[model samples]
Target: MSTALPSAVLGAAAHQARITLVRKYTSAAGVSTVVVSLAVLVLLWFVRDVQLGAAQVGAGGYIFSGFLAFGVIAAAVLGVAGELQAEREDGTLLRAKAVPHGMTGHLVAKLLAAPVDALVPVLPALVGAALLLPDSMPQDVASWVLLVLVFGLGVLTMLPWGAVLGSVFRTMIGLAWAMMSMYALAALSGVFYPVGGWPAPLQWVAQLSPLYWIGVAVRSVLLPEGAAAAEIGGEFRLELALVVLLAWAVAGLFIAPVLLRRMARRQSGSAVQAARERVLAKGY
Candidate 1:
């Protein structure tokens, strides 16, 4: 009554499952990315020529910097955390643990998958903004490189923490708190406006979060030199931005593995079934 599949076949199937999981999440996240990117671009289109700030900053360019930060947050935090929670609840995580090297492949795929899925929403907003308002975006090779560097680092900085969120919060209600935390960061991070304009205490609070520095790095690439007047020190502070973001990346690297391993170890069929029951109890 028991016929085990061949080892080679099992390995192949495992690999296929890994790819399928990546594809599944990527497809699901893509539509949202495209829609949000389009919506932002449309917003950019209307205000392509409008200006703000002491430097007479273009609204399109300002939003581009902030939107870049938001796009990364959506993909890296919300998208990745939610999928991990779903997998755990739906028994995919338990099944992955049962297969040899399956959890390894799953983690690797997920680590890479978030950014790939992130590009779905982020790249379009960036590229669209560039194409429509070339004057407002980075025009030189150097600025563009810095732009890419900061954007890449920001995602890398946040993703491990996102995993931590997924691992710690078994329920969707708890996960929703993570999204709210991001919004709270956005409110204080000066993404939508200058942080210095806030109360002195609030300015200090904004600096405590990584999103503020991310916005600064982005503004450096896209905003005019004169725009620095709006900053607390009237400068870009690129070095500080890099240091904070790098610190986050390093911290995450250390934290994600331990948390993920613990989470994987704890996952089981009964736990997943219970999670599903909780979902049903809430009426979906």
Candidate 2:
């Protein structure tokens, strides 16, 4: 019985992942978003020579790192939120709630699929940087390993919060506001420029966010040792960054399941019907 349950859960998760990927890639809006994201990434790569006054090197490495981190974080948060909201409206979540350990299977599917979903948008940028700016790419096996670790930690740090946001925000407007907040944080987090150059208060606020730490970790892996001079405090405080990311991951792990269960419990036929009506009325 124990083995059967585990097998069933894995099977369900795989099935869910296949469905999510098909729906995401085959949709017109999804294709458009991917194209736009690819364009922006290429644009940034071309402009990487731009430099800040306090930086020791051109912004190329930072731009690459920032792009990588931003992609993963945004995928974990915004991507999950938008998809979950859609699923709820379309009765997908309600259907999952009906099956044995369905929500668990769904969550497992997200855990398996979100990273792949995140990568589709980022792979082009990764390839572009490697071919066009080889110096910024990780040259050693150790650095490559570190890059993987940082990326995984970043996903862990943000994925649960994405679930929370999706569960809490029932309306598109609410989700839009949440997305705007993420953009605001990205601006402050030095995705496009050096955080050290920001005002002290803004710098502090940026540091408080997981996005900034993810950027820090990425930069540490991809940039040369001397490149640390351009970072806040003129050094990479990787230990601090690790702690911050771990803290977020731990907190999110605790909070996300509770909120998800609560959200799942509230799912009903009437709620799904109302959500569909609202979506239809909005012409979305």
Candidate 3:
């Protein structure tokens, strides 16, 4: 017998699905990863004094940590990959395929969950950075809010790509390689230092990196008045951090769905069996 779901029921179901996904992905292991990453930052703070004027330091501390937001997004990638791989292995995906709106509901739920999972670690890291490094924190409440919004948007931009990666590489070994490459690229892309200081070719490479743009946008809001503004040449106005971030978000939105659809179509029993065997042999 067919029964039509009421609008309210549908909405509630969707909301519940999203919350469940967020909780599933935002586990203790994910929190531990965030803590370790923050610990590294704290050690850095202890090693060298990041001098920004009183106001600048405060803002810089908040903005500078924006790159760490990438870690949160990376978690989303891991979640998607892990979820899909596990489901494929267990034949849960086939069961989901039987539902009327199963695939759409699942993806939407995951998409909603990604940001929450990404932000779970950021809140504590931000608080710790603020309390430990008071001088390098933003004093302005409005600026802090703006920083959060901007940083969140930046993280959102990466989710689609993460989704795409997860869908493509439905195995832990594949995911590990992708994650390592992302981290290596981010490190080399001037997240913590000036890329301009690198060799000319490397500098050019940094220009093409998304991490560079994210770092630049963060520094622009956090750095003091006299410090080199996060500009192309110190003259061009760069109020479009949000815009650049949005551009990436739009690209990901389009590409992710297409990639996921392709992955869904190609899913097979042999692939699932192999994935399960691998997982059982090596726990991710």
Candidate 4:
């Protein structure tokens, strides 16, 4: 009995170690921070010539808000996808499964660390935008606070889908495809314009994208009242943004875990070996 107890304790410790390892590995990539910086530079350059016509710098604020929200979501998804795919290909995933709590710990760590990793990138951009874009700054502290809360929740909601995709497609190419799709969806969802401005059919499609609601919620707070902000049909639809973001969060929470578990179960010997070779070849 004494021996058995020691063995169990050691097993538990090992499991915890695996989880910690996964979290550390994932956090080291820092992709979101890189992306956010790139985005800020792009935004500054793109809008350099276009002066807002009585819209206040608030228009710039609106645009940055959308970019911030999108950046969070993109970071979470890309982070998970890249980390998991790399692990899957390198046989680290298989090694993880050998430990009693390895997979569970790793997954929990990934979920926990994702938001933190995303925020590292977003916070700086927010500070810079607020300082430099005087006209587009939030009207007051309350609006800024609300925007942060809503956008943070939005990113949390989207993370599970990213995890699912990472687990399901264990290849760099597959991850790239997922990212491309995410960008395309963002475009359709009105990250750049009001979703209502799209053609009726396109509007219907845009509504399905989380970007639409996120943009709406952001615009509602930042744009001045009666600003003729782009509209969908005969109605202004900012009210739907919060609801949609919350809905996506709830849905992703339920769906992502199940999908990840299924992918875990499907991991095979050949796939694992192939993945290992790929990772080693790339020097990851």
Candidate 5:
């Protein structure tokens, strides 16, 4: 039966235009976009290193990977959600509804494009942090390559869930709450520090969110062998990390399409107009 192959193919074909648009957008983003973000990530890494001078870069390797995880989560959760919400309110989704296989195209392009969005800040930040670390970072090309691959996997692992949130919570208020919940999980997820320091209860709670596993996976690749002592149960838990991330990826793979389809089916010009009016009445 011809279920998604044709639609997915058409979507892939249509996405070239969207890719060009995203490229144009990145070009327009220019210096300030990168300069500002790199500065902040670098500064954070610097401060974190200074604060934890006991370890090299205060375990800069772990922190660096954690920072990478944070960027992925932020981009997927905040960036993707905000963009989707804006598209919905501004009738972008409605326009997609009018086009043949447009939604598929959009989703495919997103799977292709959203990581670039996540990486815009992430790549620079990672490089900057590594530069600041005078100690031996992941020096081997394989390790570096693995780090990149891990981040890409991280993006797929989380972006769909982000889209689901964007679809479910169309309002800024709802999205804000969802984001707050994410942050809460991250606060205890050992993204900035070690999980060995967290309370048992909080540690368990953090484990439930994807952020913790993401940090674990990234840290596994970037940090040295002994770094596992700083991790929960004094282990990298790479297997668990992969299982969890893969689980999320699978879940999102299935769930996002259904949610997006439902959202699309519900879209109408009147609904978009109402969203616009609501935003206007709510003020800028």
Candidate 6:
């Protein structure tokens, strides 16, 4: 009975979250996201011939792989951070705080919704890639399997830390700065180019970010063996990539709940109103 009751509560919470997500994605704002994704894909397609490395490998495969990881990171980090900040300002978090186990349910909803958030933007890009750059698509079962595995792991590793980011930055302006830093990391992490060409200290910094490892994992499955010549070590370090991503996932598991609980405990109606006033005052 104890287990069943908890399951039922969680299930109900998840259902509510699903409904909210559906409503969000079905709206005009959701259409804008799809359009933006398609626009980015078109831009990438135009640069498909910009080759990289001594192998002179086509950029299409690398772009597709890197963009795939970018989408996951966007949904897990940017999406979650933005949503939490908005919800907090609008009193949603306060309402959630009023209910029993509400914060847990809220977190569950965000985590579950994140993958879907990623897919919405990614699907259009994927279709565009397949149709426009047919050669970039995974041709074999093993490659496809690896793509899915890396993508799932990417989502798991990033979501909790994303929640932490969202919780830490209480204001929208603060969140925007955080997101810009993440974008800078993405650029340095070889999302669109080779990181091997970067300076030693910068290269080491890029490697510390999971974004770089996610790119490595995605590229391992998408690009040909010869393409590894452009990578940092001139080879696909799949084992190290897996270890790095796993370590981030494990760390996030331990860190996220504690931080989220702390964030929730601090939420109040007055705090929400004060945040709203700040936003109004700053015109952000």
Q: Between which residue pairs do clashes occur in model 5?
A: none
Worst 10 residues of 2 by lDDT: 51-60
| C-alpha lDDT of candidate 1 relative to the true structure | 0.79
Clash count (model 4, backbone only): 7
Q: Considering TM-score, where higher is better, how would the candidates rank from best to worst?
A: 6, 2, 1, 5, 3, 4
Write down the TM-score of every candidate. Answer: 0.88, 0.90, 0.78, 0.77, 0.87, 0.93
Best by TM-score: 6
lDDT of each: 0.79, 0.83, 0.64, 0.68, 0.75, 0.84
Clash-forming residue pairs, model 6? none
Better of 1 and 5 by TM-score: 1
Instruction: Give lDDT tens digits, candidate 3, residues 122-190.
Output: 666666666666644567997787667766776677777777777777676777798788878878776
**Of 4 and 6, which scores higher on TM-score?**
6
Name the top lDDT candidate.
6
What RMSD, rounded to one decimal, does every model reach?
5.2, 2.5, 4.5, 5.7, 2.8, 2.1
Residue 252 lDDT, candidate 3, scale 0-100: 85
Cα deviation of 89 in candidate 5 (Å)?
Answer: 0.5
Q: Write the residue-wise lDDT of candidate 6 on 226-255 in tens digits.
A: 888777978979889988999999999899
As for TM-score, the candidate ahead, 5 or 6, is 6
lDDT winner between candidates 3 and 6? 6
Off by over 4 Å in 1: 1-29
How many backbone clashes are present in model 3?
4
Error of 6 at 68 (Å): 1.3
Expressed as tens digits, the lDDT of each residue in 73-180 for candidate 2 is 788999998888888889999999998889889988998888887777878778877876688899989888888888888888899999999999988788999999
